[model samples]
Target: MTRKRVLCISYQFPPFAGTGVFRVLNFVEHLPDRGWDPVVLSVLPGHYERGTALDDGLCARVNGSARVHRTKCFQGIDAMLSLRGTFRGNATPASAGQGETAGTAPAGKGFWQGVKDAVTLAYRIPDKQVGWLPYALAEGVRICRHEKPELIYASGGPWTSFLIGLALKAHFHLPLVIDFRDPWMNNPYDELNVGFRRRVNRFLERWCLRRADAVIANTEPLRTLLADTAGSGNKCHTITNGYNETEYVGLKARASGTVPLVVTHVGNLYGKRTPDSFLQALTRLIDTGRLGVHEVAVRFIGHVDEARINNLIGSHPVSAMVTCVGVVPKNQALKMLFQSDIALLIQPDTRLQIPAKLFEYIRSQKPILAVCGEGATQELIEAHGLGVVADADDPEGMEGAILDVFRQARSAEGHVKKDYMAFEAGALTTQLAGVFDGVFQSSPQMKNG
Candidate 1:
């Protein structure tokens, strides 16, 4: 089989830990096994989120799996601010929902944000990172010439990643498979203004989506959104974020074969899904002795809203039982999930959000307590019979779900692991590779094919 060369332009690559990295990570990590060569074009380590560690092992795998081109650049402002307090990775989708999350972009976010908003009348900036465009374009073109990949896969956060792919598609006529890890203009979370700029962003978003041979979205809802933005009858694919059982390697148990029902929430805790109710409910479980002594511990094992955490713990019941482990390494995270009898998947509402952590929760082989969005998440969890779900916004509802998982755990008919390998990392990558394969075959110019 001939190896297909792929140029992957990812705005925030590894060393930039967050949900956004998952897009290109699978493609780059699995390309070699699938007979594709990936040339990754990305910014320097610590470019946006400083000290956000990359998985060296994963990088080694990517290094062996494909070629990487690092176009190192940084903002002096970000660097200077580093001295005062670490600028969290919460800016772009890389860490969206993690920090002060979507905190009102200050009146003076920067020149481009203001100009784009004014010009388009968009309430928010138009895919900010407008500053990164020129550099990514120049570097992407250079990589395109050198590697001359059969197809370019640009997954975004800086949004410029897709722009780079579009540039290559226009200049080299290379087949481009643009991945929308997050939506371009009409993403559910996007705060859109009422007028001209919103229309302008809609135009650019449509142009990018329509031009792509195929597009990949993280959720079915997002796929629907992309399809609507791309117009009727355009093809959009949903290849979700997942856990790799094979990559899961080995996991450590958080509790030593004991009965205290442990509820684990991993990954970014954005504003969309508040954990206050979840924590409060679990505290009630302990208070009423509904949860056996030491039987209920709620571990929030990732970056979260620290200030809110303090306030919630102060007012809510289970202050002693709730522990916030701020952003540990992935291995540690996996271990937390492994030992967990219940995986807590929280979202703000049954509204327009589906946290990527839901898939990982299912794949963790633990019972899931799904909080929020009955959209796609409820569909999959129910189909798989994975776990119980609660509404985070409803304390009683969330508490009820927690106790249900606990009851199931102690019952003789303890929940057995379902076939979650379907959501494994490599399988999902293969799903994406199929997208690339289709585009490659559609392009007539590849001489060898």
Candidate 2:
């Protein structure tokens, strides 16, 4: 069977390794089996902002799996900030979402810092990723012209990709599909969504949804939130972020009775997603002699605000057991997952987002210790009997939950045995291909194809 070509406009692709990148990378890697050939359009690696971690392995996988086109980005303030060493990651502080989550304005900022903040807030239209639009759009036009792809898929958080897809659809009259990894207008974590910027985001989100041939939200709650804007309920679908099965092919789980029971978190910790409460809870566990410092260890294996997180951990008694491993490559991170007894998930107040790490933790067969509030993350953990859930802010609840996991770990009962087949990347890609098929059939341009 001849696979139909699909132009995938993703702002975050490999070698840019992170939680979000895998969704696009995995889709690209698996779509071929579903009879869809993906042609990825992304920014040049040189254009990736400072602190955006790269994984050569993921890059190699994409290179082997698909035909990827890279273009130069208009790094204006982004380049300036990178040079200034003030900003980190692919987003400016003002474009507060993705890895750089939004937070309340810090007290006592210097005059120059305030000025920079004001300028960034005023300039960030749609997002900080807007700088990539002109470059991606031009390259997208070239790819669409030459490849004549059957459909277009644009993934967002850097919602700029959707604008590029919207433009390409306008130019070529092609079927366009948009994937929302996180909520835009109603993003719970985005406290900076206010005034003119929020209004602009609202307008852009609606405009894109109305134009998109099909819409994908990573969580079920997000699909419901986007359904109204999507115009038709059927057009918007839920295809949750999933784990790639191949990542676990050669990896072996740690023997059930490993000493110093490891509880690892494998993503960025920013904004409301902090470890203060968890550390406090762990401190209580240690003070009461429930969990010995040397008996259990906590490993944080991704990007974090080093100074802030260090301060939080330093003031705590559990700091002795806590190890901030920092950001490692995708393979190493997964290896740590296999080496651990319990996997930790920390999310508070976020209602719609179920981080990609959740699926990876499930795939590792580790008992999950979810420190979160009432939301999709909590719901999934409870529904699957995957592990224990403690309220994000309640230290007492967290203490009890940690003790529960510790008891289970001591008895060699720390592995999960729930059905995780639905969260596999290939199966999810099949669902995505189904979406592509629906769009192709319904599209006025492809009705006869």
The estimated TM-scores of all candidates read 0.81, 0.87
Q: Cα miss at 147, model 1 (Å)?
A: 2.1
Question: In candidate 1, which residue pairs clash?
Answer: 15-54, 97-270, 120-197, 260-295, 261-295, 272-348, 349-373, 350-373
Tens digit per residue, CA lDDT, model 1, 1-449 = 88888888887777566677765776687777787888888876745544456665556556577667776554533434453234333356544444443556643347545544454332133454444667778888888777778888888655657777787799998888877666566455655534665676667678888888888887787788888777743568888777656557766544435766777899877756678777677667767877654667778887788789788668555666678888887777887788887788876544434566777777666777777657767777777787787766667787788778777666643457578778788898889888888878878685556
Give per-residue lDDT, candidate 1, residue 72. 53
RMSD of each: 7.9, 7.2
Q: Residue pairs in steric clash, candidate 2?
A: none
Which stretches of candidate 1 lie above 4 Å from their native place?
49-58, 72-125, 188-197, 232-234, 252-257, 283-293, 305-310, 313-317, 350-353, 412-414, 446-449
lDDT of 2 by residue, 173-249 (tens): 99999999999987876676789999998999999999898999998888988988777888999998888888788
Q: Give the 10-residue window scoring lowest on summed lDDT in candidate 2.
A: 93-102
